[model samples]
Target chain A: MELTAPDRHLIAALEGGLPLVARPYRELARGAGLDEAEVIDRLAAMVDGGLIKRLGVIVRHRELGYEANAMVVWDIADARVDDVGDRFGAFDFVTLCYRRPRRLPAWPYNLFCMIHGRQRQAVLARIDELGRVPGAAGAPREVLFSVRRFKQRGATRLGTAAAAEAAP
Target chain B: MTTFEKRLLDEFQRGFPLVERPFAAIADDLGVTEAEIIETLGRLRDEGMVSRVGAVFDPGAIGASTLAAMAVPPGRLDEVTALVNGFDEVNHNYEREHRINVWFVVTAPHRARLDAVIAEIGERTGLEVLDLPMQEAYHLDLGFPLQWN
Candidate 1:
């Protein structure tokens, strides 16, 4: 959906979060230069358009005792990748799953899923169990545990420039 | 965190009310006063337990993005990291225990812009840039269901 000037203004207003109050949209509408009703309607439209993936409390797993985060990747055969990926997504612990292009002679793993737990041992154990899935039995896989996170922030591209221009 | 806080975090990861009084709506469902819900969320944000209470836009809808990696030598890891982080396009940069140690995500408003950023990084770093863009995703959009123990 092509965003209108008001839509950009409203999204920019939402970059941080909704104010925890009785009438949050009123606050957003004020910032976006729209009225309360339009702000709510446009936001609902954005969600319906598949632009806003989710709208609610965004939890931080690591801060909530999920310290060990592992990106377990698999080199599944092209024909069965979609099938396997679907099955992987059904697992309760698989928070994220995606199929990406595999770089030849360097990175062979294409199917990726994130399994985060409080203990490294538990995460590894879960990965071992995941490897036992029918079509996943013979696939090559590797787990990359996060060593350090230099930067972890939301994708701010949509609003950064627009917000600045709208400011003042 | 209180039991109420856990329930709030778990149950409200999505389906936030788009009404004029959203917090009040959440309060009605959770059997808490609107003021209390607001206060707890504020505390959670301070503790980093909650990133925010807002819309998570589809990054693809916003721009083009890819996961890129580089095998930076140990001595130059920090230097290389500083350089990479300097780019506004790179949002997540991490060090993992592998030969392809330094991995980061790059996002740009257009495919050409995304490619130019990756190419420039390869040139400046003099390293093979392993660009991995998503071909398909089987993601569950409801967000993570917290296992609060």
Candidate 2:
């Protein structure tokens, strides 16, 4: 998108995210040399245009006292994916849900889900319950838990060299 | 456009520097004052070029299991979104570019309820749910630079 100068300025400013402040939007307006309303309106428009995915808090579950978490992949029947996906998406616990192309030979599961909780046992119990879901029954599944948090952050581009060097 | 903005965005992708005056440190490195950096970043946020500034963690690390997506017809999207948003577990949903549209992620206190919830949704919505799961996480991060020419 050919952004206007103001748009460019705003885009550049927001790329990092809102500064923790008493009035975040007001602070942003002062920085961008635009009024508070203009800053808010532009942001709202950007969100509406599908440029900004979401505006919300980014949290650390471990710090928040949630200890256990896992990625559950499901080999759901292609024909029934839509039906099962909706049911799964409605859950309050699942934070992210999406469909990605399954890499042949390396990947077989099409349906992926995430569960987080205070304890491993608690998360596992939820997995067992998922196994009993009529729509989820007979689906091949696997759970991959994070052994260590190498890195985590909101949307931004950084560490290209470090990441590329680490890639093998 | 300044390389300072790019650097800031890049630094934040993996994580923000946990410091007393992180912005000041960033400003010093970029040859700008802390006030200038803060002002610039605020403008970017107001413009909607950036979404948020915070942490992104691995669900598995925290005990969230069961992730999935459902495809809804264009007409029924609104009704379905309302239904999905009712759950506190559902952080957010997105409209993606694919055949199986209306992708959402669900985290649960445990896996059993996650499964049951999926089943319940299927039963309630009368839609055949495709349970696609992750086998291997290869190249998961999607952080890209803002190209300014």
Task: Provide DockQ values for all models, in the order shown.
Answer: 0.63, 0.05
Tens digits of per-residue lDDT, candidate 1, B1-149, equal 78888889998988899998888898999899999999999999988788789877775665578889999999989888998898888878988888889989887656776799889888998988899988887874568777776
**What tens-digit string does per-residue lDDT give for candidate 2 at A30-148?**
75678777777776666555455444333345443455657677777777766676666666565445555564544577776667677778788888887777678888887766443
TM-score, prediction 1: 0.89
lDDT of 1 by residue, A1-168 (tens): 978777877776786688877899999898778999999999999989988888999887778888898988899999999999998988888888889998888989989998889899999999988898877888999889888888766555543756435433
Q: What is the per-candidate TM-score for chain B?
A: 0.84, 0.74
Once superposed on the true structure, which residue ranges of model 2 sit more than 4 Å away at CA?
A1-12, A30-33, A46-54, A157-168, B1-149
Indicate which candidate wins on DockQ.
Answer: 1
- Looking at candidate 2 chain B, the ten consecutive residues that score lowest on lDDT are B138-147
The CA lDDT of each predicted structure is 0.84, 0.55
Candidate 2 C-alpha error for residue A103, in Å: 0.7
